[model samples]
Target: MTQVAELPASAAEARDHVHALMATCPRPCGEDALTDALLIISELVTNAERHGGGMTGFRARVTEDHFDVTVEDASPAHPTLPGERPAGSVGGYGWHLVRRLATSVAVTPTARGKSIHVGLRLR
Candidate 1:
């Protein structure tokens, strides 16, 4: 199934929406993949709110083999991860985690902003 939500000021709101989407999945989603998906949603939405100048849209698509997520924000700046996270650093870790959790990630620059597309394996 597919689900979409307007990007909200609060990351928690976005997180809840993603959870609702996952709950509607036609097939059973494993705990590990589900957890990873939720964390990815939280990180992307939070990043959009904090650095992308707020989120514009969010979407998710689920299939037998994989789940896809796309997040849009108001800034044209694409997200990037550091070569390596410094030990003991608390922040600036979201993008790195997202990369590791997602099987594939793409950044597309839009007219007014950018969209981050992430694909996660379901199995």
Candidate 2:
């Protein structure tokens, strides 16, 4: 399994970790997939810190067909799609982007928080 000894403190660190791992994976994802994966990582981590209390853990791994990332945060609330708002909304698009880019997304609840697992198909 692809693993990290120390959990990353921020989205950049998490993306760096995944980028390095992708280099070693037998089937690396495409450039567009890489960009999408990074954005997914960033949105999830930022959401954890900004809305879900704070991030508690993070992990990224590559399988034969998918690049997977999981972000754990200190909240039980499941993420929701952005509801109707002003015509020119500044934010709340992150979750939607994640859902669109990821091949699959799952949320698991824990005693203290929740973990969001997002997977992107590899080329």
Q: TM-score of the candidate numbered 2?
A: 0.88
Q: In model 1, which regions exceed 4 Å deviation? A: 84-90
Write model 2 residue lDDT over 18-80, tens digit each, in one string.
778777767666888788878898999999998899998887887766788889999998876
Per-prediction TM-score to the true structure, in the order listed? 0.85, 0.88
User: Evaluated with TM-score, which candidate comes out highest?
Assistant: 2
Query: Between which residue pairs do clashes occur in model 1?
Result: none
Identify the runs in model 2 with alpha carbons over 4 angstroms from their true place. Answer: 84-90
Worst 10 residues of 2 by lDDT: 1-10
Tens-place lDDT per residue, model 1, 21-92, is 777777888889889998998999889988898888887777766888899989998776665556665588
Q: What are the candidates' C-alpha RMSDs?
A: 2.5, 2.1
